[model samples]
Target: MAENQGFIGSIVETVKTVFWALVIAGIFRTLFFQPFWIPSGSMKDTLLIGDFLFVNKMAYGYSYASCPAIRIERIGIDLGPDDFCGWFEDRDGRLFGSEPERGDIVVFRHPVTGRDFIKRLIGLPGDRIQMKDGLLHINDTPVEIEDAGIFAEVMAPQGPLGLRPQCANGAVGEGATCEKEKAIETLPNGVSHSILNIGRRSADNTGVFTVPADQFFFVGDNRDNSTDSRFPQAAGGVGFVDRKDLVGRADRVMFSSAGRSMLAFWTWRSDRYFKALE
Candidate 1:
């Protein structure tokens, strides 16, 4: 009887330990930081398709959007931030919130889709933004850009989505080199970062865009490949994102993998481990 009781006590302790561990993890993810995986190449060389980083939720303070959205298709569980913090959704601003800086890489929720998106904050509220002749213009003055050679990658499927990269060198056989023109772009705030250009398209030239109050403008680092503020939300683009939708800032890439699965240890890119973002 004593042996059976001991076995039962061990099972109870194990359950208790797991319950506490989950509680702690939930708190950490909700209040401090949240893990974000890059599933698209919109950010490109700056943030690759398989890069993994933690968003600093405390940086901009908590809000309805700060709550994590859990979606598990296999188990049929889908919960958004609004579902968990619906009361906070009606609030005007964030709790202890601060304004985001221009040129900062930010992760925000799509105003229409409620989906998370990571992009560089290009324009502040009431800022005039436009893309003229492939150059970024803020308040009628164009940002500086210097040629930075070429960015090349293998012409193969990337990430789990199996998305093929668009190349500046035009179409090539699989496994061939795919290239894009790279340049160092300096924002008005003096923040400099690399941008990849895959030739000109409609997004290269756009009329002036006046950002609305309490709204922010974002753009992808891969200039030609990005469908950012330059396009309207009705056109399937991320129009002006609201301030309340801001999630957090991604400071560094904790890990990166080139393979379809992150568990593919051999596909890990050791050079990007803990690499600080500019």
Candidate 2:
């Protein structure tokens, strides 16, 4: 009888440990940092598909959008930020709110879709943003861009989505070298980052976009590939994102995998571990 009682006691202890661990993890995720996985190459070279990082939630303070969106398709569980913090919605501003700097890489919720998107903050409120001849223009002045040679990668399936990259050298078979024109673009704030180009498209030229108050403009580093603020939301683009939808800033890449599954140890990119983002 004593042995059976001890076994039961062990089970109780295990359950208690797990319960406390989960409670701590939930609080940590909610109040501090939120883990984000890179599922696209829109910010290629700077942030790649399969890159994992934690968003600094405290950077811009808290808002209704700061609440986590838990979606586990396998278990049929789907919850959005609105479900968690909807009571906080339609508020004027964030609690302990801080303004985001220009040229910072930001993750924000889509104003219309509530989907999360990561991009470089380009235009602030009331800033004029435009693209001309495949160059970024801010306030009627073109940003400085210098050639940085070609960014090449294998023309194979990337990440879990199996999405192949678009190449500047036209279509190529799998295992072939895919290339894009790389350039170092300097934002008006003097923040410089690498930008990739896959030839010119409709996004390369646009009429002046006058950002409204409390709204900001964002663009992808992979210029031609990203559907960012340059396009209208009705037309399938992010349009102008509101300040209240800002989630957090991604400061570093915790891990990165080139394969479809992050558990595939051989496919891990060791160099990207704990790499600081610019």
Candidate 3:
């Protein structure tokens, strides 16, 4: 009887430990924060592949993951990736406190594939958004573009860098290129970034859609590479993010994998560290 009781006690303790761990993980995954990885070049020059981002689940509050099933109640729902990614749950009833603002970088779930994506907010509801000659126009206002010199992508004839070049100075992420093959465009909002407008390589998208209520229109900073609302939702895009599906407002890029990882310490890039998701 004593041995049996001891065995039972051990089992109970293990169960308790597991329960607490799961509860903590669930809470972290649902209410406070969640982790995401960049898997595509759709948002290149902004977010590279292998970059990990911490999604602020609290930003869009009342996470749909907290709800066990379809609930009749309305307030204080718990939403996790499951609901945000549209895996198990069909719809989450979370409402609005503040809508996604223009020029805000956001990570929303894809409408068609139900995958998470990150992009910049360009147009708001009731705004006329159009792309002309590869330039973005909001309400017919041409966003200002300033050329911050030319930007050239350098390949080490390999990955990010196989050997630290002689010109490698000013620490990592500070950039050491004296020449680039592209030009950087800074918008009127003081948001400056680079785009690879190689040739008249055809953006292949031209249309205008009204931003629906409680929804937002997004585009990638790497306008040419990003697969955003510019394309129809049928083309595996992050179409008009619904309020309920707004997983979180991207506050900051806590960290990012510098796209290339090598065993040689010199190959490790310290850039994109603690970068804000602007």
User: How close is every model to the real structure, measured as TM-score?
Assistant: 0.96, 0.95, 0.71
Highest lDDT scorer: 2
**Best-performing candidate as measured by TM-score:** 1
Single out the weakest 10-residue window by summed lDDT for candidate 2. 89-98
lDDT of 1 by residue, 69-185 (tens): 899978999888998887898788888747799988998888888888999999999899998888999999999999999999999999988989999999988999999999999
Alpha carbon deviation, residue 50, candidate 2 (Å): 1.1
Q: Which ten residues in a row have the lowest lDDT in candidate 3?
A: 163-172
Better model by lDDT: candidate 1 vs candidate 3:
1
- Residue runs of model 3 more than 4 Å from their true location after superposition: 1-8, 63-96, 151-196, 259-268
lDDT of 3 by residue, 1-278 (tens): 99999999999999999999988886666666777666655555566555667777665555343222222335865443565444534654564345556766677766656456778777776777777777777777767765654434443332333322111122334344523224455554566665544333355336666787767788876565667887777666666776655666666555555435535455444676677654
lDDT score at residue 240, model 3, on the 0-100 scale: 78
Estimate, for each residue in 95-193, the C-alpha lDDT of model 2 and write its tens digit: 884789998889999988888899999999999999999999999999999999999999999999998999999999989999999999999989999
